[model samples]
Target: MRGRFSQAWSDVLRGSAFPHEGQAFLEQVFSADVFRPRPDHGGREERFALTYERLRHINDRVREAGSTVPLVQDRERLFPLLAWSAVADPALFYAMFLHHCMTTGAVLEFGAGREDLADVLEELAATERVGALLMTELGHGNSNASVRTVAEYDADREEFVLRTPEPAAVKFPPAVAAEGVPRLAVVLAQLVVDGAECGEFCFLVPLRDADGPLPGVGVRPLQPSPWLPLDGAVVSFDGVRIPYRFWLRDNAVLTADGGFTDPFGSPAIRARRTLSLIRFAWEAAVVGLAATAGASAAVAVRHAHRRRTGGRFAAGRPVIRYRNQQRALFGALSGAYVARLVAAATAGPEAPALTPRSVRTTFLMKVVTDRIAERVSARARTASGALGFLAANRFLDYQGFAHSLNAAAADNQMLLLDGAQALLAGTAYTPPADEAPAAGDRDLLDPATWETLAAVRERILHQELADGLRKATGSGLAPFDAWNGLYDLAERLAETHAARLVLGTVREAVREVAGSDPVTGPEAAGILRDLLALHALEELAGHDGWYLAEGLLDADEVRGIPALLDRLCERLEPYAEELAEALGVPYPLVGAPIAGEDYVGGLAGTAPSSGTA
Candidate 1:
């Protein structure tokens, strides 16, 4: 079994067409041994301290090797690195996120060589100064426009006085917690000048000197959790003052005469522009969740291939050969693959700027990817049985991380509701007519068939929602009441739109792989085609009710989906290990001791001496 798995792994590595630089970087990361977790010290505080210490060491190694330069400077390498580091460790991944995504982006976008900030951008890039983004408040969450934290202009001193009026105004979870004092923070506060509300803007506040928190600033660490090992804190400000120039005034400015001016006519527009920094966090969440899901799938497949159990046909056979086990593990593998493609396409460089459409796309991507991660991790854990329940296996850790990803930067349900609103407003997506395939094709294996199915479903759902909303409002229902009546339809429409986007992305990826390399193109395409079909069938099966109610498909077609999925899974069984390997999670990062080669033999050696007793 080990020999066969190794051969399949080799085939996958040789068959897939990864970018040259990404492949080389992945090789370096695996060879460098920088991502190993520290041994447990049997206490929460001790474990947290050890995890953070390891995180700093990993950061130093990453910096020394310049592994993150590509991520900061080039868009092409960002997704690959994001995918790889996410499988390493959550604490380390968050640290890298602070350094590359939060700190570097904040400095480059807002603080480059500004005299008021004392060239903080250069310091941030060189790691001489560390930074955090303090945007979400305990009371307001990410509703920046309504946050209680205030930055009032002091006209006499030409400074901004920052204050947290209530306990709810405190910022919690500022990325790099418990590591040390952060030198700077991009604070989101309601800007007030002369008792008039100007708007919400980010002010660069100095949080700490070499010794401790700056005067008037307070930082208290939250209780430790083994699930997410960051030093999360509640940070408050009491009349903390900084020069007016420290305000990130790209969208609005404070005049010397104590007047506020913004090129954008409305304060709402300015606030929207100011909040574009959330895109980076969204991308991080998407990529990290996808990577975690992929890693979980890898571990599950490895365990399934090694562990044997009694079944109807045999006394002892590999668990992976069972139909139920194959469906669970392969289904997870497919979801992970789809998630990776979605993350890459949504956050890729060519994606539009931070417009409403792009924002909606990012939100949809987050919701879809996070849901996929949750489902995949759960399925993978169950497939691994007893071994999966152990913390040392890391599946449980992945599951927690997946749940946290859904709730982290933004809540998944809220994001789905926001997408629903977009649909109601007719600002949501509509597939181009030319791209839709001809109808009545039962070949679920064809990419065009799946594309057409997704597009048609989205169109039908959107029209249904539009009609229902119009009638409810026309009948004198209140605006909120009308929306409430159609809330379920609206949510379904958003999900359909996301499914269409995922199918389109998967089709494009299959084409890219098939066209890129002559030696491995056909082999890779075959595997991806099977995975794609499984993904489409599974989605269709879940939405069978919608299809039947809309007359999109006859009952026969709906009933045949299970059989089709089974066939596809059977065809994919031989290549399950290969497909998991193609996801690029390093073997060492699969932390389950049972997932290793000699688990059975090792357990035998450690068994108790029963005869003497």
Candidate 2:
């Protein structure tokens, strides 16, 4: 049981040395008493205090360890721990909040040509200062281009006066709030120079010092949210003044004569460029959601292996052996794999920067991962029965994470629609000449077959969408009304495109494993291939109607997907533990006592139960 798993685990460890080291360090620190939350606390305030203290200790330890601060220098190592931290305590995970600051600062230095701010960024990173991004407002939400917060330039004073003109202009959802911990913030405000609205830009404003809020800054903590443990609040500026040099003039510049000049012709273009800082949040969200899905699946699978139900068998079989159980739990396991692989591919070092293509990719991947994590968490919860509802299992926490992720960075629906618009405006898909195996003629397990099926499905969805839009417009409907009428179709197009992308990614991963060292490669590839098949088949099973309507599959072939999924599940059952372990989910992060090997005995507080047979 351990041979293939051990080999694959070793391969992962060897492939990324930093994550191994980082995991070790995290396990050590997380084991400390100071890091644990006091769940028995009677009130929300007490719980919040304990959580806050634990977070502070963790931050102190991170600083002491000299890990990547402000900006991630080595994501391969730090990302794993970040993922684990998100699972363990999402509140503590919020403490590592310098990435956007670093990104905004970098954009200013490179894109805005504010080269002089480079040293400031380095100092912020080195000092490990907590930096908040104040962009989202009560009125605008994620529509940063229309924010009412203004940063008007003062020529003689050579400073920018930040003001929230109305109640709606107050920046909400800032993690710092009244905590007074975040000493600085990259405030996104409309750049007004000489009475001209130049557009949105980032300015490094001192939010607080050791003594507390700056002269004209007010931080009012928002009503507590039951889901996210982090403190969030509305930050209002009452004529807060900062030096002109604090402006992150990435695509725009302030002239000496109190004039603004930008390469982009319009304020809207510059505002869009400035809002690209959200990419960091999107990447972090992808990694965090993948980890959440992996951990949820691990807990569900472990519980399934331990829990038993009596039936026609002599004693009883593990719940995982049940077809329904396998369908619910194993499907989630496949989703976890898909999310992790897609996140890894999207967030790699060489990934493109802040372009329209990169932004769309990030948005699509983030939405996909969030949706997968949510579905997997729900399935995991259902599979675990009563055990999943217990606080000790952290299923509820995982559920909260799913909701928070969907709402974080930007609303998931909004992001999906944004991606849809980009897709529609770009090139239309050209369907291949029936590359997929006809009905019963293809090998369901073949990677090529799965790739072709996914690609063809995506193409079909795209073509159908294009035809629908053309017809809608041709019928004399306004463009916006036509799009609004086809909102559901647009969403389906985005989902289909995402599905195709993830399937392609998994196919490549399987091929890589197969082509590696002959010793472990074959075993790893075989297991991954089954997972890939299950993923593809499950998807096809869900969308069988679409396939049938598009003439991509016959009724018999569509009906066969369920049986194929069951066969795949059975072949992979013996290696379920190994598959979950390969996801690199730390054992302690499982956060459920039922995941233990002797959960049956432990639950009874006695000898092992014969039912576990």
Candidate 3:
């Protein structure tokens, strides 16, 4: 049984040397003492306290291993833990990412050569102080280039005075002081020297200590975020002085004569390099969202398998016997697998340099995964009925994460539009190779056929968008006006491109898994093939109209998708339990009573301890 799915899936999901170690760490720290199910009802402060404790407990255990953070030092191990964390709690996941990936990652990457920064990193690693990265401001949310917060060089004092020039300049959503833990942030502010703007740069600044907010720093709590709760707040600075040594520079120096010398020729490039740590944040979001999506589907499937109901045709039959339940639950499960596969390939340990192309790739991968998570979680929640609505069931946790990730790094829609504009303007985009119309003649169940159709659609859409823009611009329409004329198609093109990219990633993984594991190789290969087929069909089903319009498919083919989906769902029903258990979400983390053998008995807190099967 273990060889069937859990072991095979675990081998594929973890791309690092720390698979067993990661699982051990989760089991050790997530014992009853450190980990607890979220309360059915709790106040904001109460919930915030739980999130804080969760962060501290995990960091404490990691410190016990070594002085330097292992995962941060070698991020190959980060995604596995992030996925597990997301299955547990979205808020906990948020805090963990900010501390380990955002704050600690930035320091490790750029805070070299500074003894003060080293001390701060040590404290952060030891969980003595919390960490955050503040780049977005209330005034210019998501527009980092136009941040109004300024750090003016005080040459006489050999320091920088960091100040939020106005109310709008206040940093929003840092969760800085409410935890009552010592906190530090890597802040992005415009550098000003002698009344001249010197591009955006990062600085290490202390935001709070055990006592309270640091002097010259003001913190105000914002309303708790819906579904996903954290101690988020808006922070302002009043002449907060930062020592010259605190500046995070990448071989950039301040000359004694008050001149700045940077090896990177341009400030824009320097700024991009400064915020490159954001890639880790994106990776974290992908892994976490993938895990949550999978876990949600798992719980929903388990419930559907056990849940019995009466209908006009049958009495006391398992809900999984019904067509509606199978479609909702199995489809979600298939999507979950697709999401996990995509994350495994895209969010690898190796970090790519930040560029327009890489940024777009990361953004679109995140967007695609985010959409999958949202859809899977919503279907899971609905499939479970009233039981799913209960906080103790854990479906809501995935729902919250899915919704939050859509806007977490930046709003997905805005990013999609921005990415579309870049692609339209030829920002290093490589469209999928155009395929011949005959490519569509292959069986719909063939992954190759899905890949071909998706690629052809993307290529056609890109060409149409480019030609439309050119024709409109040549007709004397403003660039924005011309682009606006095809806004719907532009967005569709972006989505199709993202879907193709994810499909390409899934295909690669399937090929690798087919040849890699000898023990359960055939079984694993069979499972992946089925999942890949279902995922591909799901992606193409939505654009059936477009596919028919473009002659990629005939009316009969398009009309057959519904029945095809139902058949796929029925085929996957037997393996649903194995798939859910193989996701590696600990039973305790799910905390769903209905998922247990005896739902009624388990409701009294008699569920088995949290651990993998």
Best by lDDT: 3
Per-residue lDDT tens digits for candidate 3, residues 17-108, read 33566677767777745466654537777777778888888777766766454466556556766777788788888988998888888777
TM-score of each: 0.89, 0.89, 0.94
- Give Cα distance to truth, residue 509, candidate 2, Å: 1.2
With a 3 Å backbone cut-off (N, CA, C), the pairs that clash in candidate 2 are 112-249, 112-250
In the order shown, the candidates' Cα RMSDs to the true structure are 4.6, 3.7, 2.4
Q: Which stretches of candidate 3 lie over 4 Å from their true place?
A: 1-6, 16-18, 67-70, 113-116, 353-356, 437-440, 516-523, 604-613
| Candidate 3 whole-model C-alpha lDDT, 0 to 1 | 0.78
| Candidate 2 TM-score versus the reference | 0.89
Candidate 1 lDDT by residue in tens digits, 354-439? 67787888878988988999899899999988877877667777888887776776777777777877866767455435344434
Which runs in model 1 stand beyond 4 Å of their true positions?
1-18, 24-34, 39-71, 76-78, 112-118, 175-179, 209-212, 349-352, 428-440, 517-520, 601-613
Report the alpha-carbon TM-score of model 3 versus the true structure. Answer: 0.94
